[model samples]
Target: MSRTPNPTRTLASQTLFRGLDVVDAVADGCQSVQEIADRTGVAFSTTHRLASALVQARYLQFEPRRGYRLGTRLLELGFAAYRDSDIARSARQNIEQLAGETRDTVHLAMLDGDEIIYLDKIDAQRPIGVNSRIGGRKPVCCTGVGKALILDEGEASWRTRYQYDAERGNIHLPLETWLAGMHAYAQGGYAFDLEENAPGIRCVAVPIRDASGKTVAAVSVTGTTDSTDEARLRSLIPTVRGAAQAISAKLGGTLG
Candidate 1:
């Protein structure tokens, strides 16, 4: 079910993701209508309509003789996004410094509905392939950077958004139980990913707030739990917060 989302994404961004499912299915070579429907869980008519919409938007092209091909709009939009994104421009230097200072992977992310998208990343001295890349998306509830980004939304929105976890097999938790932990994290001004998203990988994150106290972004330090102990990870909270605060300040954020 859909939930109230942040201003960064349209309320219908969830639906857009579903539409993107069709786009992804086609990209994966699901050529026929039936194949696309079977892959997308959308009805046959809906699939056809979505394809038509995409064709109209120039995100997809129909081949009367062939099947389908991606349109140039996707590439154009991708390039335009990278070029116009100000977060990476503002935060990349600070992220690099954080990585150098901590020797841990550092990331900058922005919330996109119930997911967070990586806007930039800086690898540490010891590279750990976290299966994450620029433009990659991860679930909000299970990620440190994600929780940090939403910390300001408080318990009610958290409850609504955290009702289901698709990647975690739709696991459900009591609202009170989850909110207690989230409130504590908010009070402390940071969050932790304790192997919640990916096994053996832990992360510490802090919210990047704008001048209006809105959490516009988040920054995180990530490392393997084996290499980064609880104490060491906790110690990184200050560094992560500093980096995030610096970026927020660069974006005209003023701590009230």
Candidate 2:
């Protein structure tokens, strides 16, 4: 009852592959009009047009002298893809387990440009904390779950992947603070939200891996600062971690 895809046809209009190529070309220090054209083997005029369009769409940046590079638009697109992906459905059980185990709000989030998109959530029974819901967005630089998922790629790589764009003139938390959190996340199995996204809501999170063993999502439990005490959070870690691992397994992850 199924069919195999035609490889050639699939590759031509493959948004994933094309998007990856665009991202890679820009990341590899490709600068300006000619550089991207030369690298992509796209005609100069066509490349110019594409670049202009991408810049307008926020997928590519055009500097006065430096030329084109990947833009925050990619993040927006990436987040949307991840949030709507099968991985999100695969992680539902994990979200439920985390919520039940911790008796707190549980959330599943996927990375967007420099933020995290809440694909799903299990609200707390106690109703003692923030009323986060599905489709909520939070800064990746500050949230516990977002930082932990980002840590799966190593500090340097995560920094590169989620680098802030000065062109947008959008600044929130300091880079140094974020870097410190990244270091902490690398050392710790789970990351802490620490009232970063909200003043009274605290959260703890673990990473969710996909079939290729890539951290594609983050599962987290959130509660009020008063309830997320050190002991309670510590007790909830293993439960959260186990749930994340189970979801990762469903996604075909082979976590090391």
TM-scores, all candidates, are 0.77, 0.61
Off by over 4 Å in 1: 1-21, 27-33, 40-73, 166-177
Best by TM-score: 1
**lDDT of the candidates, in the order given:** 0.83, 0.74
Which has the greatest lDDT? 1
- C-alpha RMSD for every candidate: 6.9, 10.9
- lDDT by residue (132-247, candidate 2, tens digit) is 65666666766777787787667676666446532333325566776777787777768887777778888889888777767788888888977777677777778888888888
Off by over 4 Å in 2: 1-84, 157-177
- lDDT (C-alpha) at residue 253 in model 1: 94
- Residue pairs with colliding backbones in model 1 are none
Q: Model 1, 168: alpha-carbon shift in Å?
A: 6.4
Flag clash pairs in model 2.
32-67, 211-252
